[model samples]
Target: MSRVVATTTLWRPTGPEELALVEASGWAAWPPRLPEQPIFYPVLNEDYAIRIARDWNVPASGVGYVTRFEVEADYLARYPVQQAGGRTILELWVPAEDLQEFNQHIVGPIEVVHEFRPQA
Candidate 1:
């Protein structure tokens, strides 16, 4: 018998410094969420990730990164996709404490799909 696996994509927008740190860490998991952060929000699509990586990260940090990874659809069933700011923006809000577990569900290493460096 054959089986099919369902996968869902997730994206994270990060600053170059953080991206470098993540890459150095051997492409395993994202850094631990900050103390005050209630949820670790991973955007649903590349477009939103790029917007943040450019409009936000570039001006503030001089460079931005967009990471892409897939997780089992069943594993992510508990969380709901949220629309914020507008129709094009959607993301998953995973509680900070559950982040490590979330990372475990990721099928493979995270890939930096896009990089944006501010030109001076």
Candidate 2:
């Protein structure tokens, strides 16, 4: 089955380091696995992104970034969304090994939507 992805999709609340890689690589992928980061997470909505940026990243790292991009939505159907921590936060978790396939699914370049940096 084909899923028609909207003209745009949302990826969000990225830390500065990760954001740099995404900007450089041209697509978002799962970061290297550590005990802390076991999966690659890409968010699917703005509300969730905002929550992460404001409530999580800013408090934790003092900065967050949201990126917008066009992906082959049909390919996204292969992955399942995981909801945790609370409602309103929905994201896809791509396993580390499967990340290549995930990256392949992205249709084009990624663009930054908003940068959340708290003034010190």
Candidate 3:
């Protein structure tokens, strides 16, 4: 039987220092293999989301596919500005079959974001 695995991450614009740090780290670039993009949403906090993405080795674009689960109303109140901007909670659906493989390899969501190019 297939089970749904939720991978999450926080995606905000990278600051200058963070960008520089990434460049200085000299990490190797990897080809995208995941069938879907990474998904970001309100249901998962930045910490949890980041953890899941790394665990799954999801690409930046693929991260868009992560779905929001168990989001609360009070959480919405915290983001009044986003609501004013008409930004609803974003969610992505990944096939349950893919979850196991991702969980096995990805240590966290930051690792997933690391795979994505800044411009791409």
TM-score of each: 0.90, 0.76, 0.21
Considering every candidate listed, which one attains the maximal TM-score? 1
Clash pairs detected, candidate 2: none
- The whole-model lDDT of each prediction reads 0.87, 0.71, 0.33
Best by lDDT: 1
Per-residue lDDT over 5-95 for candidate 1, one digit per residue giving the tens place of the 0 to 100 score: 7889899999877677778868878777889888988999789999999999989998888999888899999999999878979999999
Candidate 3 regions off by >4 Å?
1-5, 21-84, 88-120
RMSD of every prediction: 1.9, 3.8, 14.9
What number of clashing residue pairs does each candidate have, in the order they appear?
0, 0, 25
Task: Tell me the spans in candidate 2 whose CA falls farther than 4 Å from its real position.
Answer: 1-8, 26-35, 85-87
Worst 10 contiguous positions by lDDT, candidate 2: 26-35
**Model 2, 1-120: lDDT tens per residue?**
976555437475777877777766756553455567667777878878877877778777778777766667677777777886677678888777777776666666776778787877
lDDT of 2: 0.71
